[model samples]
Target: MLKTYSVSLAVGILAGLIYAVLDVNSPAPPIIALVGLLGMQIGEHLIPLVKRLINRQPVNLHWFRHDYHHKIGDNPPPSGDKTS
Candidate 1:
Protein backbone atom coordinates (compact mmCIF):
# COMPACT_ATOMS: atom_id res chain seq x y z
CA MET A 1 0.00 0.00 0.00
CA LEU A 2 2.81 2.37 0.82
CA LYS A 3 4.53 1.53 -2.45
CA THR A 4 1.36 2.09 -4.41
CA TYR A 5 0.78 5.44 -2.73
CA SER A 6 4.38 6.45 -3.19
CA VAL A 7 4.27 5.69 -6.92
CA SER A 8 1.00 7.54 -7.31
CA LEU A 9 2.41 10.61 -5.57
CA ALA A 10 5.52 10.44 -7.73
CA VAL A 11 3.47 10.32 -10.90
CA GLY A 12 1.26 13.14 -9.72
CA ILE A 13 4.29 15.27 -8.95
CA LEU A 14 5.75 14.55 -12.38
CA ALA A 15 2.50 15.52 -14.03
CA GLY A 16 2.38 18.72 -12.02
CA LEU A 17 5.89 19.56 -13.17
CA ILE A 18 4.94 18.97 -16.78
CA TYR A 19 1.85 21.11 -16.42
CA ALA A 20 3.91 23.88 -14.93
CA VAL A 21 6.48 23.71 -17.71
CA LEU A 22 3.70 23.88 -20.29
CA ASP A 23 1.79 26.57 -18.39
CA VAL A 24 -1.39 24.54 -18.65
CA ASN A 25 -4.22 25.00 -16.20
CA SER A 26 -5.44 22.01 -14.24
CA PRO A 27 -8.76 20.73 -15.55
CA ALA A 28 -10.31 20.84 -12.10
CA PRO A 29 -9.68 22.36 -8.68
CA PRO A 30 -8.09 20.20 -5.96
CA ILE A 31 -11.32 19.36 -4.23
CA ILE A 32 -13.03 18.48 -7.48
CA ALA A 33 -10.11 16.36 -8.54
CA LEU A 34 -10.17 14.52 -5.21
CA VAL A 35 -13.88 13.87 -5.55
CA GLY A 36 -13.32 12.56 -9.04
CA LEU A 37 -10.68 10.21 -7.70
CA LEU A 38 -13.10 9.01 -5.06
CA GLY A 39 -15.68 8.38 -7.75
CA MET A 40 -13.11 6.40 -9.69
CA GLN A 41 -12.34 4.25 -6.66
CA ILE A 42 -16.01 3.56 -6.15
CA GLY A 43 -16.49 2.87 -9.83
CA GLU A 44 -13.66 0.37 -9.68
CA HIS A 45 -15.54 -1.63 -7.06
CA LEU A 46 -18.99 -1.05 -8.52
CA ILE A 47 -18.29 -3.01 -11.69
CA PRO A 48 -17.20 -6.13 -9.86
CA LEU A 49 -19.99 -5.76 -7.34
CA VAL A 50 -22.52 -5.63 -10.15
CA LYS A 51 -20.89 -8.55 -11.87
CA ARG A 52 -21.22 -10.62 -8.74
CA LEU A 53 -24.88 -9.71 -8.57
CA ILE A 54 -25.46 -10.56 -12.19
CA ASN A 55 -23.81 -13.91 -11.67
CA ARG A 56 -26.14 -14.62 -8.78
CA GLN A 57 -23.24 -14.62 -6.38
CA PRO A 58 -23.59 -13.64 -2.75
CA VAL A 59 -23.03 -9.99 -1.80
CA ASN A 60 -22.76 -9.46 1.89
CA LEU A 61 -20.81 -7.58 4.50
CA HIS A 62 -18.13 -10.25 4.51
CA TRP A 63 -17.63 -9.84 0.80
CA PHE A 64 -17.37 -6.10 1.16
CA ARG A 65 -14.75 -6.45 3.88
CA HIS A 66 -12.74 -8.94 1.87
CA ASP A 67 -12.92 -6.89 -1.30
CA TYR A 68 -11.85 -3.76 0.50
CA HIS A 69 -8.80 -5.48 1.89
CA HIS A 70 -7.98 -7.07 -1.44
CA LYS A 71 -8.12 -3.79 -3.31
CA ILE A 72 -5.94 -2.06 -0.75
CA GLY A 73 -3.46 -4.96 -0.73
CA ASP A 74 -3.90 -5.14 3.01
CA ASN A 75 -4.67 -8.48 4.62
CA PRO A 76 -5.49 -9.90 1.23
CA PRO A 77 -7.52 -13.06 0.91
CA PRO A 78 -5.84 -16.45 0.55
CA SER A 79 -4.29 -17.36 -2.78
CA GLY A 80 -6.77 -20.19 -3.34
CA ASP A 81 -9.69 -17.81 -3.04
CA LYS A 82 -11.15 -16.10 -6.13
CA THR A 83 -12.38 -12.92 -4.43
CA SER A 84 -9.50 -10.83 -5.59
Candidate 2:
Protein backbone atom coordinates (compact mmCIF):
# COMPACT_ATOMS: atom_id res chain seq x y z
CA MET A 1 0.00 0.00 0.00
CA LEU A 2 2.72 2.42 0.95
CA LYS A 3 4.71 1.52 -2.11
CA THR A 4 1.70 2.01 -4.36
CA TYR A 5 0.99 5.46 -2.98
CA SER A 6 4.66 6.34 -3.12
CA VAL A 7 4.93 5.33 -6.73
CA SER A 8 1.73 7.15 -7.60
CA LEU A 9 2.93 10.33 -5.88
CA ALA A 10 6.31 10.08 -7.53
CA VAL A 11 4.77 9.62 -10.96
CA GLY A 12 2.36 12.47 -10.40
CA ILE A 13 5.17 14.77 -9.36
CA LEU A 14 7.30 13.74 -12.30
CA ALA A 15 4.42 14.26 -14.69
CA GLY A 16 3.65 17.67 -13.18
CA LEU A 17 7.26 18.74 -13.47
CA ILE A 18 7.39 17.70 -17.12
CA TYR A 19 4.12 19.40 -17.93
CA ALA A 20 5.04 22.59 -16.11
CA VAL A 21 7.40 23.37 -18.94
CA LEU A 22 4.60 23.27 -21.46
CA ASP A 23 2.23 26.14 -22.21
CA VAL A 24 -1.54 26.05 -21.71
CA ASN A 25 -2.03 25.44 -25.43
CA SER A 26 -0.18 22.16 -25.29
CA PRO A 27 -1.95 18.84 -25.92
CA ALA A 28 -1.17 17.74 -22.38
CA PRO A 29 -4.59 18.94 -21.29
CA PRO A 30 -6.47 16.33 -23.27
CA ILE A 31 -4.29 13.48 -22.09
CA ILE A 32 -4.52 14.71 -18.54
CA ALA A 33 -8.26 15.11 -18.91
CA LEU A 34 -8.58 11.55 -20.13
CA VAL A 35 -6.44 10.24 -17.31
CA GLY A 36 -8.43 12.22 -14.78
CA LEU A 37 -11.69 10.94 -16.20
CA LEU A 38 -10.46 7.38 -16.11
CA GLY A 39 -9.15 7.84 -12.62
CA MET A 40 -12.48 9.15 -11.45
CA GLN A 41 -14.27 6.37 -13.24
CA ILE A 42 -12.20 3.58 -11.72
CA GLY A 43 -10.01 4.89 -8.92
CA GLU A 44 -11.78 3.22 -6.04
CA HIS A 45 -11.66 -0.15 -7.75
CA LEU A 46 -8.07 0.44 -8.80
CA ILE A 47 -6.48 1.39 -5.47
CA PRO A 48 -7.57 -1.71 -3.63
CA LEU A 49 -6.35 -3.75 -6.57
CA VAL A 50 -2.96 -2.11 -6.26
CA LYS A 51 -2.96 -2.56 -2.52
CA ARG A 52 -3.78 -6.23 -2.81
CA LEU A 53 -0.95 -6.67 -5.27
CA ILE A 54 1.48 -4.79 -3.07
CA ASN A 55 0.62 -6.78 0.04
CA ARG A 56 0.77 -10.10 -1.77
CA GLN A 57 -2.80 -10.69 -0.74
CA PRO A 58 -4.46 -13.78 -2.16
CA VAL A 59 -7.45 -12.05 -3.68
CA ASN A 60 -8.53 -11.17 -7.17
CA LEU A 61 -8.63 -7.58 -8.43
CA HIS A 62 -12.45 -7.48 -8.68
CA TRP A 63 -13.05 -9.28 -5.40
CA PHE A 64 -15.62 -8.45 -2.77
CA ARG A 65 -13.40 -6.03 -0.91
CA HIS A 66 -13.01 -3.53 -3.74
CA ASP A 67 -16.08 -4.17 -5.92
CA TYR A 68 -18.52 -4.76 -3.07
CA HIS A 69 -17.94 -2.62 -0.04
CA HIS A 70 -20.74 -3.70 2.26
CA LYS A 71 -22.21 -7.00 1.21
CA ILE A 72 -21.01 -8.40 4.50
CA GLY A 73 -22.09 -6.49 7.54
CA ASP A 74 -20.11 -6.19 10.77
CA ASN A 75 -18.55 -9.47 11.69
CA PRO A 76 -19.51 -11.14 14.94
CA PRO A 77 -17.01 -11.34 17.74
CA PRO A 78 -14.81 -14.35 17.78
CA SER A 79 -15.01 -17.13 20.41
CA GLY A 80 -13.22 -16.96 23.77
CA ASP A 81 -10.03 -18.08 22.08
CA LYS A 82 -8.79 -14.47 22.43
CA THR A 83 -6.69 -14.69 19.34
CA SER A 84 -5.20 -11.58 17.86
Candidate 3:
Protein backbone atom coordinates (compact mmCIF):
# COMPACT_ATOMS: atom_id res chain seq x y z
CA MET A 1 0.00 0.00 0.00
CA LEU A 2 2.79 2.43 0.85
CA LYS A 3 4.57 1.68 -2.38
CA THR A 4 1.45 2.21 -4.42
CA TYR A 5 0.84 5.52 -2.69
CA SER A 6 4.35 6.72 -3.46
CA VAL A 7 4.12 5.79 -7.12
CA SER A 8 0.72 7.42 -7.47
CA LEU A 9 2.07 10.63 -5.95
CA ALA A 10 4.89 10.73 -8.46
CA VAL A 11 2.59 10.14 -11.42
CA GLY A 12 0.14 12.78 -10.18
CA ILE A 13 2.87 15.41 -9.89
CA LEU A 14 4.16 14.63 -13.38
CA ALA A 15 0.68 14.89 -14.84
CA GLY A 16 -0.01 18.17 -13.07
CA LEU A 17 3.24 19.69 -14.37
CA ILE A 18 2.40 18.66 -17.91
CA TYR A 19 -1.07 20.10 -17.62
CA ALA A 20 0.28 23.40 -16.26
CA VAL A 21 2.74 23.74 -19.14
CA LEU A 22 0.02 23.10 -21.68
CA ASP A 23 -2.35 25.54 -20.04
CA VAL A 24 0.23 28.32 -19.93
CA ASN A 25 0.19 28.79 -23.74
CA SER A 26 -3.55 28.39 -24.07
CA PRO A 27 -5.20 31.41 -25.74
CA ALA A 28 -8.31 31.37 -23.59
CA PRO A 29 -8.37 30.04 -20.07
CA PRO A 30 -12.08 29.17 -19.95
CA ILE A 31 -12.08 27.37 -23.28
CA ILE A 32 -8.84 25.64 -22.45
CA ALA A 33 -10.22 24.51 -19.11
CA LEU A 34 -13.30 23.08 -20.81
CA VAL A 35 -11.23 21.22 -23.36
CA GLY A 36 -8.83 20.00 -20.71
CA LEU A 37 -11.74 18.66 -18.67
CA LEU A 38 -13.25 16.99 -21.74
CA GLY A 39 -9.91 15.50 -22.61
CA MET A 40 -9.70 14.08 -19.11
CA GLN A 41 -13.13 12.49 -19.44
CA ILE A 42 -12.23 10.95 -22.78
CA GLY A 43 -8.93 9.67 -21.43
CA GLU A 44 -10.67 8.13 -18.44
CA HIS A 45 -13.11 6.31 -20.71
CA LEU A 46 -10.48 5.29 -23.20
CA ILE A 47 -8.06 3.86 -20.63
CA PRO A 48 -10.39 1.12 -19.41
CA LEU A 49 -11.53 0.36 -22.94
CA VAL A 50 -7.98 0.01 -24.19
CA LYS A 51 -7.04 -2.04 -21.15
CA ARG A 52 -9.91 -4.43 -21.67
CA LEU A 53 -9.18 -4.72 -25.39
CA ILE A 54 -5.52 -5.44 -24.78
CA ASN A 55 -5.84 -7.77 -21.77
CA ARG A 56 -9.18 -9.33 -22.76
CA GLN A 57 -10.15 -9.60 -19.12
CA PRO A 58 -11.99 -7.76 -16.44
CA VAL A 59 -9.76 -5.80 -14.10
CA ASN A 60 -9.34 -7.04 -10.56
CA LEU A 61 -8.65 -4.55 -7.75
CA HIS A 62 -5.59 -5.20 -5.59
CA TRP A 63 -7.46 -5.19 -2.30
CA PHE A 64 -9.62 -8.22 -3.05
CA ARG A 65 -6.61 -10.56 -2.80
CA HIS A 66 -6.73 -10.20 0.97
CA ASP A 67 -10.44 -10.13 1.64
CA TYR A 68 -10.07 -12.95 4.15
CA HIS A 69 -7.13 -11.24 5.84
CA HIS A 70 -9.18 -8.15 6.57
CA LYS A 71 -12.10 -10.19 7.84
CA ILE A 72 -10.09 -12.08 10.48
CA GLY A 73 -7.73 -9.24 11.39
CA ASP A 74 -5.92 -9.68 14.74
CA ASN A 75 -8.20 -12.52 15.85
CA PRO A 76 -6.83 -15.31 18.07
CA PRO A 77 -6.83 -18.94 16.96
CA PRO A 78 -10.00 -20.98 17.39
CA SER A 79 -10.20 -23.83 20.00
CA GLY A 80 -9.97 -26.66 17.44
CA ASP A 81 -6.58 -25.43 16.21
CA LYS A 82 -4.87 -26.21 19.51
CA THR A 83 -1.04 -26.38 19.66
CA SER A 84 0.69 -29.46 21.11
Candidate 4:
Protein backbone atom coordinates (compact mmCIF):
# COMPACT_ATOMS: atom_id res chain seq x y z
CA MET A 1 0.00 0.00 0.00
CA LEU A 2 2.80 2.40 0.84
CA LYS A 3 4.53 1.64 -2.44
CA THR A 4 1.31 2.20 -4.35
CA TYR A 5 0.76 5.53 -2.61
CA SER A 6 4.38 6.58 -3.24
CA VAL A 7 4.16 5.82 -6.95
CA SER A 8 0.85 7.65 -7.27
CA LEU A 9 2.23 10.67 -5.40
CA ALA A 10 5.33 10.76 -7.63
CA VAL A 11 3.28 10.56 -10.82
CA GLY A 12 0.92 13.31 -9.61
CA ILE A 13 3.86 15.55 -8.72
CA LEU A 14 5.51 15.00 -12.10
CA ALA A 15 2.28 15.77 -13.92
CA GLY A 16 1.78 18.94 -11.92
CA LEU A 17 5.34 20.03 -12.61
CA ILE A 18 4.91 19.46 -16.34
CA TYR A 19 1.68 21.45 -16.39
CA ALA A 20 3.28 24.31 -14.41
CA VAL A 21 6.30 24.45 -16.72
CA LEU A 22 4.06 24.58 -19.77
CA ASP A 23 1.86 27.26 -18.15
CA VAL A 24 -1.15 25.22 -19.29
CA ASN A 25 -4.18 24.33 -17.19
CA SER A 26 -4.82 20.69 -16.43
CA PRO A 27 -7.21 19.21 -18.98
CA ALA A 28 -9.54 18.28 -16.13
CA PRO A 29 -10.05 20.63 -13.23
CA PRO A 30 -8.78 19.37 -9.84
CA ILE A 31 -12.26 18.87 -8.37
CA ILE A 32 -13.41 16.88 -11.39
CA ALA A 33 -10.30 14.73 -11.29
CA LEU A 34 -10.76 14.20 -7.54
CA VAL A 35 -14.37 13.10 -8.04
CA GLY A 36 -13.30 10.65 -10.73
CA LEU A 37 -10.62 9.24 -8.43
CA LEU A 38 -13.19 8.93 -5.66
CA GLY A 39 -15.52 7.02 -7.94
CA MET A 40 -12.74 4.66 -9.03
CA GLN A 41 -11.77 3.99 -5.42
CA ILE A 42 -15.36 3.32 -4.47
CA GLY A 43 -15.74 0.89 -7.35
CA GLU A 44 -12.53 -0.88 -6.46
CA HIS A 45 -13.85 -1.57 -2.96
CA LEU A 46 -17.41 -2.35 -3.98
CA ILE A 47 -16.69 -4.77 -6.83
CA PRO A 48 -15.52 -7.53 -4.54
CA LEU A 49 -18.52 -7.10 -2.27
CA VAL A 50 -20.88 -7.16 -5.23
CA LYS A 51 -19.28 -10.33 -6.55
CA ARG A 52 -19.49 -12.00 -3.16
CA LEU A 53 -23.16 -11.11 -2.96
CA ILE A 54 -23.84 -12.50 -6.43
CA ASN A 55 -22.09 -15.74 -5.41
CA ARG A 56 -24.18 -15.88 -2.21
CA GLN A 57 -21.19 -15.62 0.12
CA PRO A 58 -21.19 -13.77 3.39
CA VAL A 59 -19.26 -10.53 3.42
CA ASN A 60 -16.36 -11.03 5.80
CA LEU A 61 -15.01 -8.03 7.64
CA HIS A 62 -12.52 -9.91 9.82
CA TRP A 63 -9.74 -7.74 8.51
CA PHE A 64 -11.24 -4.72 10.22
CA ARG A 65 -10.69 -6.21 13.65
CA HIS A 66 -8.48 -4.16 15.94
CA ASP A 67 -6.19 -7.11 16.63
CA TYR A 68 -5.94 -8.24 12.98
CA HIS A 69 -2.18 -8.68 12.84
CA HIS A 70 -2.24 -9.97 9.25
CA LYS A 71 -2.10 -6.43 7.95
CA ILE A 72 1.35 -6.02 9.55
CA GLY A 73 2.73 -9.19 7.91
CA ASP A 74 2.56 -10.94 11.26
CA ASN A 75 0.86 -14.23 12.01
CA PRO A 76 -2.51 -13.67 13.60
CA PRO A 77 -2.47 -14.25 17.30
CA PRO A 78 -3.38 -17.79 18.30
CA SER A 79 -7.13 -18.35 18.58
CA GLY A 80 -6.93 -18.60 22.36
CA ASP A 81 -5.13 -15.25 22.46
CA LYS A 82 -7.70 -13.42 20.40
CA THR A 83 -8.88 -10.37 22.35
CA SER A 84 -12.35 -10.56 20.93
Candidate 5:
Protein backbone atom coordinates (compact mmCIF):
# COMPACT_ATOMS: atom_id res chain seq x y z
CA MET A 1 0.00 0.00 0.00
CA LEU A 2 2.81 2.38 0.78
CA LYS A 3 4.38 1.53 -2.54
CA THR A 4 1.14 2.15 -4.36
CA TYR A 5 0.62 5.53 -2.75
CA SER A 6 4.25 6.51 -3.20
CA VAL A 7 4.20 5.69 -6.90
CA SER A 8 0.95 7.58 -7.39
CA LEU A 9 2.31 10.66 -5.64
CA ALA A 10 5.48 10.49 -7.71
CA VAL A 11 3.50 10.26 -10.93
CA GLY A 12 1.25 13.14 -9.91
CA ILE A 13 4.29 15.29 -9.14
CA LEU A 14 5.83 14.39 -12.47
CA ALA A 15 2.60 15.29 -14.24
CA GLY A 16 2.50 18.64 -12.47
CA LEU A 17 6.08 19.36 -13.47
CA ILE A 18 5.35 18.46 -17.07
CA TYR A 19 2.28 20.67 -17.09
CA ALA A 20 4.32 23.58 -15.73
CA VAL A 21 7.06 23.03 -18.29
CA LEU A 22 4.53 22.84 -21.15
CA ASP A 23 2.39 25.67 -19.81
CA VAL A 24 -0.67 23.45 -20.35
CA ASN A 25 -3.46 23.61 -17.83
CA SER A 26 -4.91 20.41 -16.39
CA PRO A 27 -8.01 19.46 -18.34
CA ALA A 28 -10.23 19.27 -15.28
CA PRO A 29 -10.38 20.85 -11.84
CA PRO A 30 -9.03 18.81 -8.95
CA ILE A 31 -12.43 17.92 -7.55
CA ILE A 32 -13.65 16.76 -10.93
CA ALA A 33 -10.50 14.73 -11.43
CA LEU A 34 -10.92 13.11 -8.00
CA VAL A 35 -14.50 12.19 -8.75
CA GLY A 36 -13.42 10.67 -12.05
CA LEU A 37 -10.80 8.64 -10.21
CA LEU A 38 -13.41 7.43 -7.74
CA GLY A 39 -15.65 6.43 -10.60
CA MET A 40 -12.79 4.53 -12.21
CA GLN A 41 -12.12 2.62 -8.99
CA ILE A 42 -15.77 1.67 -8.69
CA GLY A 43 -15.93 0.71 -12.35
CA GLU A 44 -12.98 -1.63 -11.96
CA HIS A 45 -15.04 -3.95 -9.75
CA LEU A 46 -18.31 -3.76 -11.64
CA ILE A 47 -17.51 -6.23 -14.39
CA PRO A 48 -16.27 -8.93 -12.04
CA LEU A 49 -19.23 -8.39 -9.75
CA VAL A 50 -21.69 -8.61 -12.60
CA LYS A 51 -20.11 -11.81 -13.82
CA ARG A 52 -20.29 -13.35 -10.36
CA LEU A 53 -23.95 -12.45 -10.08
CA ILE A 54 -24.71 -13.75 -13.54
CA ASN A 55 -23.14 -17.06 -12.56
CA ARG A 56 -25.34 -17.14 -9.43
CA GLN A 57 -22.41 -17.08 -7.07
CA PRO A 58 -22.80 -16.02 -3.48
CA VAL A 59 -22.21 -12.43 -2.42
CA ASN A 60 -21.86 -11.89 1.27
CA LEU A 61 -19.68 -10.30 3.91
CA HIS A 62 -17.47 -13.36 4.04
CA TRP A 63 -17.06 -13.29 0.28
CA PHE A 64 -16.36 -9.60 0.37
CA ARG A 65 -13.78 -9.82 3.13
CA HIS A 66 -12.12 -12.90 1.74
CA ASP A 67 -12.35 -12.22 -1.97
CA TYR A 68 -13.54 -8.93 -3.42
CA HIS A 69 -12.09 -6.39 -1.03
CA HIS A 70 -8.49 -7.51 -1.38
CA LYS A 71 -8.65 -7.28 -5.17
CA ILE A 72 -9.47 -3.57 -4.89
CA GLY A 73 -7.26 -2.54 -2.00
CA ASP A 74 -4.45 -3.53 0.31
CA ASN A 75 -3.83 -6.89 1.93
CA PRO A 76 -6.36 -8.14 4.45
CA PRO A 77 -5.68 -8.30 8.14
CA PRO A 78 -3.72 -11.28 9.34
CA SER A 79 -5.70 -14.47 10.00
CA GLY A 80 -5.26 -14.22 13.74
CA ASP A 81 -6.81 -10.76 13.88
CA LYS A 82 -10.40 -11.28 14.97
CA THR A 83 -11.29 -7.60 14.69
CA SER A 84 -11.65 -7.92 10.97
Candidate 6:
Protein backbone atom coordinates (compact mmCIF):
# COMPACT_ATOMS: atom_id res chain seq x y z
CA MET A 1 0.00 0.00 0.00
CA LEU A 2 2.78 2.38 0.86
CA LYS A 3 4.56 1.49 -2.36
CA THR A 4 1.40 2.04 -4.39
CA TYR A 5 0.80 5.45 -2.84
CA SER A 6 4.45 6.39 -3.21
CA VAL A 7 4.38 5.54 -6.92
CA SER A 8 1.16 7.52 -7.41
CA LEU A 9 2.66 10.52 -5.64
CA ALA A 10 5.80 10.31 -7.77
CA VAL A 11 3.72 10.13 -10.97
CA GLY A 12 1.59 13.07 -9.91
CA ILE A 13 4.67 15.13 -9.15
CA LEU A 14 6.21 14.21 -12.50
CA ALA A 15 2.98 15.17 -14.28
CA GLY A 16 2.86 18.51 -12.48
CA LEU A 17 6.47 19.15 -13.46
CA ILE A 18 5.68 18.37 -17.09
CA TYR A 19 2.69 20.70 -17.07
CA ALA A 20 4.83 23.45 -15.54
CA VAL A 21 7.52 23.00 -18.18
CA LEU A 22 4.97 22.99 -21.00
CA ASP A 23 3.22 26.11 -19.63
CA VAL A 24 -0.14 24.37 -20.05
CA ASN A 25 -2.99 24.69 -17.59
CA SER A 26 -3.42 21.70 -15.37
CA PRO A 27 -6.76 20.03 -16.09
CA ALA A 28 -9.16 19.55 -13.18
CA PRO A 29 -10.92 16.60 -14.82
CA PRO A 30 -8.01 14.21 -14.42
CA ILE A 31 -7.67 15.03 -10.72
CA ILE A 32 -11.34 14.26 -10.12
CA ALA A 33 -11.13 11.22 -12.38
CA LEU A 34 -8.49 9.56 -10.19
CA VAL A 35 -10.51 10.31 -7.06
CA GLY A 36 -13.61 8.83 -8.66
CA LEU A 37 -11.69 5.77 -9.75
CA LEU A 38 -10.36 5.29 -6.21
CA GLY A 39 -13.87 5.67 -4.82
CA MET A 40 -15.20 3.04 -7.23
CA GLN A 41 -12.44 0.64 -6.27
CA ILE A 42 -13.13 1.15 -2.57
CA GLY A 43 -16.84 0.67 -3.10
CA GLU A 44 -16.31 -2.47 -5.15
CA HIS A 45 -14.40 -4.07 -2.28
CA LEU A 46 -16.44 -2.69 0.60
CA ILE A 47 -19.97 -3.16 -0.76
CA PRO A 48 -19.86 -6.90 -0.31
CA LEU A 49 -18.62 -6.55 3.25
CA VAL A 50 -21.32 -4.00 3.97
CA LYS A 51 -24.01 -6.30 2.57
CA ARG A 52 -22.75 -9.18 4.68
CA LEU A 53 -22.82 -6.95 7.74
CA ILE A 54 -26.43 -5.84 7.09
CA ASN A 55 -27.55 -9.47 6.75
CA ARG A 56 -25.70 -10.51 9.95
CA GLN A 57 -23.42 -12.79 7.99
CA PRO A 58 -19.79 -13.41 8.73
CA VAL A 59 -17.43 -11.54 6.43
CA ASN A 60 -14.82 -13.91 5.11
CA LEU A 61 -11.59 -11.94 5.34
CA HIS A 62 -9.37 -14.87 4.47
CA TRP A 63 -9.43 -14.15 0.76
CA PHE A 64 -8.80 -10.47 1.33
CA ARG A 65 -5.76 -11.14 3.53
CA HIS A 66 -4.57 -13.83 1.18
CA ASP A 67 -4.72 -11.46 -1.76
CA TYR A 68 -2.89 -8.72 0.09
CA HIS A 69 -0.13 -11.10 1.07
CA HIS A 70 0.02 -12.42 -2.44
CA LYS A 71 0.41 -8.90 -3.84
CA ILE A 72 3.30 -8.22 -1.46
CA GLY A 73 4.83 -11.63 -2.12
CA ASP A 74 4.77 -12.39 1.59
CA ASN A 75 2.90 -15.68 1.29
CA PRO A 76 4.65 -18.83 0.26
CA PRO A 77 3.49 -20.85 -2.72
CA PRO A 78 1.65 -24.09 -2.04
CA SER A 79 3.87 -27.01 -1.18
CA GLY A 80 4.48 -29.65 -3.81
CA ASP A 81 2.77 -27.59 -6.45
CA LYS A 82 4.78 -28.21 -9.58
CA THR A 83 4.54 -25.41 -12.12
CA SER A 84 6.46 -26.00 -15.27
Candidate maximizing TM-score: 5
lDDT value, residue 14 of candidate 5: 80
Across residues 1-84, which tens digit of lDDT does each residue of candidate 3 receive?
A: 999999879967776788677666533478876887788677755765577669885544332222222333545444464332
Q: Which stretches of candidate 5 lie over 4 Å from their true place?
A: 1-25, 80-84
Predicted candidate 2 versus true structure: per-residue lDDT over 39-60, tens digit per residue: 7558756776688779997674
TM-score of each: 0.51, 0.32, 0.39, 0.43, 0.56, 0.37
**Candidate 6: lDDT over CA atoms?**
0.65
The stretch of ten residues in a row with the least summed lDDT in candidate 6 is: 63-72
Clashes of each: 0, 0, 0, 0, 0, 0
- Please give the TM-score that candidate 6 achieves against the real structure: 0.37
Candidates 1 and 5: which is better by TM-score? 5
RMSD in order of candidates = 7.0, 8.8, 10.8, 7.6, 6.7, 11.3
Per-residue C-alpha lDDT of model 6 across residues 1-84, encoded as one tens digit per residue: 999999889978877786678675667468765875687578766776687679997655554453333444556545664332
lDDT of 4 by residue, 7-68 (tens): 98997888678768967577658886687578766776677668767999666555334343
> Per TM-score, what order, best first?
5, 1, 4, 3, 6, 2
Best of the two (3, 5) by lDDT: 5
- Candidate 1 per-residue lDDT, tens place, 1-84, comes to 999999999978876786678676776568866876897688877898899999998998668767655676667676677755
The predicted structure with the larger TM-score, 4 or 6, is 4
lDDT value, candidate 4, whole model: 0.66
Show pairs that collide, candidate 6. Answer: none
Which candidate model has the greater lDDT, 4 or 5? 5
What's the distance in Å from true for residue 12, model 3?
7.1
For all candidates in order, the CA lDDT equals 0.76, 0.61, 0.59, 0.66, 0.76, 0.65
Which residue runs of candidate 2 sit more than 4 Å off their true CA positions? 25-32, 35-84
Candidate 5 lDDT, 1-84, residue by residue in tens:
999999999978886786678776786578866875787677878887888899999888767777767666688845874543
